[model samples]
Target: MSMIFSWRRRRAGRGRAGKDEFPDMELSIPTHFRCPISLDLMKDPVTMCTGITYDRGSIEKWINAGNNTCPVTNQVLRSFDQIPNHAIRKMIQDWCVENKSYGIERIPTPRIPITPCDVSEICSRIEAAAQRQDAKKCLDLLKKMKNLAKESERNKRCIVQNGAGCALAACFELFASFSIEEYTDFLKEILSALTWTFPLGDKGKSKLGSAISLRCIALFLKGDDLSSRKHAVLVLKELISEDQDFVNSLMEIEGIVEALFQIVKVPICPTATKASLVVLYRMTLSENSEMITLKFVDMGLIPCILEILVDGDKSICEKALGILDSISSRDQGREGMYENALTMPLLIKKILRVSDMATRFVVSILWKLCMGENENAVVEAMQLGAFEKLLVVLQVGCGERTKSKVTELLKLMNLYKDELDCFASSARFKFLKRPN
Candidate 1:
C-alpha cells in the first residue's frame, strides 16, 4: 500500500499542468489540494464537521460574515469547531518543498487558535491578582490581553466572551481607589484593555458605572496621557449610553464636563471628539439639564460647537448640532448663540449644506434666536443670505418641521423687509412671497 501510494503521489506530481496554476514554471497543482471556497492551494487547512476542508482564513471569514452552513456541501454547521487537517497540511508542505524550484514557498506552521479556555485562564489570573492586590501582576496580564486583542478580531471576541470584560471592570473598580500616583500604570492598562473589550454585558456596564469608576475616568480625562484620556472618553460614552442614571453621577464628578469640552476644543482624535460630544449630549438629557445647559453656556460650549461646525465631518457635525440644539432650549443658550459673531454665518452656511437633520437643527436654532425679541438676528441672517437659503430649502425638500420654521422665518424676514436697506430692491425678495 505504501509503494502504491508513493507511486500515485509521484504520478500526480507529473500530471497535466494549467497555464494559470504556475505561470512561470507551468506546474500542475492537484485539484484536491485547492480550497473549495477560494480555489487556491489550502494553507492551514481546517476540516469542518461536514468533512469539507478549506483554508483557515477563508472559512473563518465566511463564518464571521454570519454563514451557518458549509460553503460547498450546503450542510448546516452543527458546531463552529474547526479541526486542523494536519495530514493535508503535511502533504501540502511536502508538495511545496518538491516544487521549490518553481518558486513555491513553504507555508509556516499555524499558531494555536485562542480558545475560550485560554481566555478563562487569563481572566482567572487577573481576578486572582486583583484579589491579592497585586498591581504589578495585574498590569502585566492586562498588557498581555491588550496585545492579544490587537492580534485579531477573533481573539477579541474570544476574550470578551470568556468574562475578560467583567474581570477588567472589577480590577478597575478595585484599583481606582488607590493613589493615582502609585497605580497609574496599572490603572492605565486596565482602561486600555477595557476599551478593547467593549459591548460589555450589563454586569460589566454596571460595574463600570459605579461612582468610583466615574471618578477614576474623570481623572484620566484630565491626565496628560492622551491615549488614556481618549480611552476614558470612549469608555465614559459607553457607560452613559448604557445607563442614563449614571449621567447624574457623572455630572457630580468635579471637572468632568470641563474635561469633555476641552477634548472637543482640542480633539485628540476624531473618535474621542465624537465620544465627548455624545457624553455632553447625554448630560443635557438629565433631569437637571437646564442647569447643565447653563453650565455649558458658561464654559464656552457654543463657540466650541461652532468651531466643530466649521470643519467637522458629517457625523461629528450632526452630534455637535444635536448638543447645540439642546443648549438652545435654554435662555442662556440662545443668548450665547446671539453673542457670538460667527454663530450666524456658520449656522447660515450650514442651513442647506450639511444634511436634512443638520438643516433642521440650524433652523431650530435660528428660530429660537429670531422668534424672540431679537431683531438683529433676523437682520443679520437676512444680510448673510438667510432669505435666499430658506428659499433654496423650500425649492428643494425639507422635513415638515423644518419647512414650517422656514415659512415662519420668511414671514419674520418679510416683517423687517421694509425696515432693512437691502430687502426691498433685491431680486431674491420675489422668491420670499408667502407660500399659500
Candidate 2:
C-alpha cells in the first residue's frame, strides 16, 4: 500500500510538470505569491505590522507617497517596520525553479533597505564633524552620503527626510563665515550635498538665504572649479525669496551680478545658464529695476540675450526674452538693443516662431523700441516684413493685451506704408494680406 501511494504522488507531480511544459497551458500561480499593492510576483516579499505581505519596492513607494495604512486592509500601521518574509521568498524561488521550463526566472535576494535610523545616524555624524570643524571627516562623511543618494531614489529620500539637508545647511552657514581659502573643499562638498536635497524644506532654504551663505556662494561662483560653479548657481536659484528687500540684498553681494553674467556670457551648461537667467530676472522685480537694467546693459547683457534668442531652446528663449523685455524699459536698454545687429531681425523671427509667451515678449520688446520718436525702428520693422507677422499675430489669435499692442504697432507701421511699398512687395512679404 505504501509503495502504491508513493507512485501515485510521483505521477501527480509529473503530471503538473508536463502541463507546465505546454506553451498554451495557463499556469495558475499561488494567490499568496502576488503582492497586494502591485499584483505582481513578489521579488522581495516583506511582511508589514498588519501581517500582510507585499513586495518591498511597492510598499516603500506607497509609504513614500505619504500613506500610513496597509493598502489591502486599510488598517493604520502602528510601525513602518517591514520584516523579510524569508519563507515566502524561498517558496516563490522554488516555484520559479520548478516552472523554469515555462520561462519563469527565480527572484534574487533583495538587499537591506536603508531605514530612517541609518540616515539619522549619518546626519548626526555630519553635524558633529561640522561642529568640530573636522574638514577631512566632514568631507568623507559627505562623500559617503552623496554615494548613498546616488544609489537609489529611496536612499535620497531617506537622507533628506532624516535631516541631512538642514545639517548641510548649518554646515554652510558655519563655514561660510570663515575665510574662503581656509575651507574651500569643505564648502564645495556642502554645496554639492545640499544640491542633492533640492526642493528643501523651509528651514533649509531660510538658512541658505542668509547673507553669509549668499556671500559664500558668490565666492564659489568666482572659483575655477566648473562643478562648484554650477552647484553654486543652482543653490542660489533655490534661495531666491519673493521679498523685495531680500532680492535687493543680493545686489549688495560684491561681484555677484558680474559672476552670474560671466556664466551667461560663457555658459558652463544649459542648466547653469537658465539658473543665472532666473536669478537675474528675479533681481529686476525690485523697485530699482531701472538702475539694475542699466547695470545689466553696461555688462553687455543685450548682445548675450540676442545670441540666446537666436538658437536657444524654448524655455531658455522665453527666459532670455523676459530679461530682454525688462531691460528694454529704459533708454539705455533700447540703445543697447539697437546696437546689436541681430536684435530687430531676431526679435521678429521669434514673433510667431516660439511659444505664445515668446511671441508676447517679442511684441512688447518691439513696441518699446518703436514707441518713442524712433522712425528708424518703424522702418526697420516694415522692411523686415514685420507688418505681415503682426497681421498673422492678429489673425492667429493672442491675449487681449498682445492684440492691443499688435493693433498699435500696425497703426505705427501704416505711417511708414508708402515708403515701405517696395520692401513689402518683396517675395518675403508676398504671403501677407492686410487685415481690414
Candidate 3:
C-alpha cells in the first residue's frame, strides 16, 4: 500500500522533466537471473563471460560515485559497453510492478523493549510463598516467573537487566540461604540462559559472556555452599576446555586477565590469589604439562605474569612466581623449558627502567627465584649490565631504606664478598673509613 503511493509520487516527479534531456530510464532483467547484490530480479542487465548477469546502469552509477566494485564482494567491474536489450528491461519492470516490494530496502531491527518488571512485586510473592514454608510452591513460582520473563523477552516486551539478582532473591526468600543442591540448580539454569545471549561475531558479546562467567565463578567460589562451588568449577572447566574458538578467544580480551588478577591480587582478600593460583598450579599438574606450558607461553602469559610481578600486587606476584616455579621444576630434564629463563634478561632490563618502589621490591624476589641452576640467568643479568647498576643502587645513593634493602639482597647473593677485602685499599673506602 505504501509502495503504491511512492510509485505514484515518483511518476509525478518524472513527468516534470528538466529543461535538459535525460538518458532513457528503463528497468531490465535477463530471463531466469537475479542480482546477487540486491537479491532482486536484475535490471539493465550486463552479461559477463562467466555467464553472470548484472544491472549495468546501477553498477555504472555506483562506480562513477567512487564505489567501483560489485555490491557483494566489492570486485571491480569493467565499463558497460553494451546496453541491455529492451525486452530484458520490460521483463524486470513487469516483475517489479507485480511484486511491489521488490528491490525495497529492509528496515532496521526495532530497539529492545524497555518494559521493566516490577522487582519488588515479584519478590513479595516469592517471599509470601516462602513464609508459608511451601518449598514446592516456592520452586514452582520461581520457575513460573522465570518462564514468564523469558516469554516476555522473546516477545520483545520485558527487560530484566539482572537475572541473577532475581534468582538470588527468590532463593533467599525460600531458605534465607540456599543449599548447595538448590543453588547449583539455579546457577546452571541462569548460566544456560545467560550463555544464550551471546551473538555470533560480536566481540562485545564475547567480552560480556566472559565477564558474567567470571562474576558467577567468583561468587560461587566465595559462597560457603559446597555444591555451588563445585558447579562453578564444573562450569569454569567447561569454559576453559572448550574446543570452540568463540569461548577460547576470551583469553585475548584486554583487561580480562587483569580484572581477575585484581581480585585475586589483593593480599587482604581471603583466599586471595587462592583460586587463581590454583588454576595456574593445576595447569602444570596435567599429564600433558608440555601442552599447557606451550599454550600459556604462546599467549604471552609469561610476560603478563612478569608484569603482574612488577606491579607489586604482592600475593599475585608471589603466585605468578610459584606458577613459574612449578612449571620450571617440571622442565628440569626437559630441553624446552630452560629457554623460558631467556626472558629474564628482558624482564630485568624493563624492571630497571621502571621507577616504582613496589616494582623494584617484587623484581628483587628474582634473587629467590634464580637461586639455583640460574647461572644462565646471572649471566644474562650481567650481560644486561645490571650488576654494577644494582651495586650502585645498593650504596648510600639510592633511597635510604631502599638502599639498605638492596644491600641486603646483594649480600644474600654474596655478590661483593671477594671485592670487599680488595675495597679496603681503594681511595673511596679510605674516605668512607675516615668519615663520621
Q: Number of the top candidate by lDDT?
A: 1
- Estimate every model's Cα lDDT from 0 to 1: 0.86, 0.84, 0.47
**Model 2, position 424: C-alpha lDDT score:** 50
Model 3: how far is 339 from its true place, Å? 17
**Which 10 consecutive positions of candidate 2 have the poorest summed lDDT?**
1-10
Say which candidate scores most in TM-score: 1
In candidate 1, where is summed lDDT lowest over 10 consecutive residues? 1-10
The local lDDT score (0 to 100) that residue 8 gets in candidate 2 is 14
Q: Order of candidates by TM-score, top first?
A: 1, 2, 3
RMSD of each: 7.8, 8.1, 20.3
Candidate closer to the true structure by lDDT (higher is better), 1 or 2: 1
Alpha-carbon deviation at 156 in model 2, angstroms = 1.8
Candidate 2 regions with alpha-carbon error over 4 angstroms: 1-42, 46-86, 92-108, 115-121, 241-246, 422-436
Q: What does candidate 2's lDDT look like per residue over 1-436, in tens digits?
A: 0111011112234535552222254466787998888878899899999999999889999998999999999999999999999999999999889977666788887767677898888878977987887878888888888888877677788888888888788778877776567998889889987776765566776777788888888889988999999999888776673233556778888888899999999999999999999989887777788888899999888888888887899989999999988888888889998887898899888988989999999999899999877998888877788999999999999999999999999998998897667665686677889899
When summed lDDT is taken over every stretch of 10 residues in candidate 3, the lowest stretch is 1-10
Write one digit per residue (lDDT tens) for candidate 1, span 1-436: 0111111112233455732232232567787788888878888799999999998889999998999999998999999898999999999999989977666789887766789999999989998998898998988888888778777777878898888988899888888766666788778878877876776677777778888887888999998899999999999898778788989999998889999999999989999999999999999989999999999998889998998899888889889999988888889888898889999998899986778888888889888889987989999999898998988998998888888989999999988877776645676676787879
lDDT tens digits, residues 1-436, model 3? 0112122113224556655443444434334546554545554565543334565545555555786555665556575243444455566566656545334332222223222355445545656766675566656655655665565343222223423244333434234234435555544444433333222123323332354445545565455554444444434434444323423343444443443444343332434344455455455555556656666555555655555555544455455655665555444312233455545654455444445443354344445344445555555555555556577555425566556555554554456434543654574566565546
| Number of backbone-clashing residue pairs for each candidate, in the order shown | 0, 0, 2
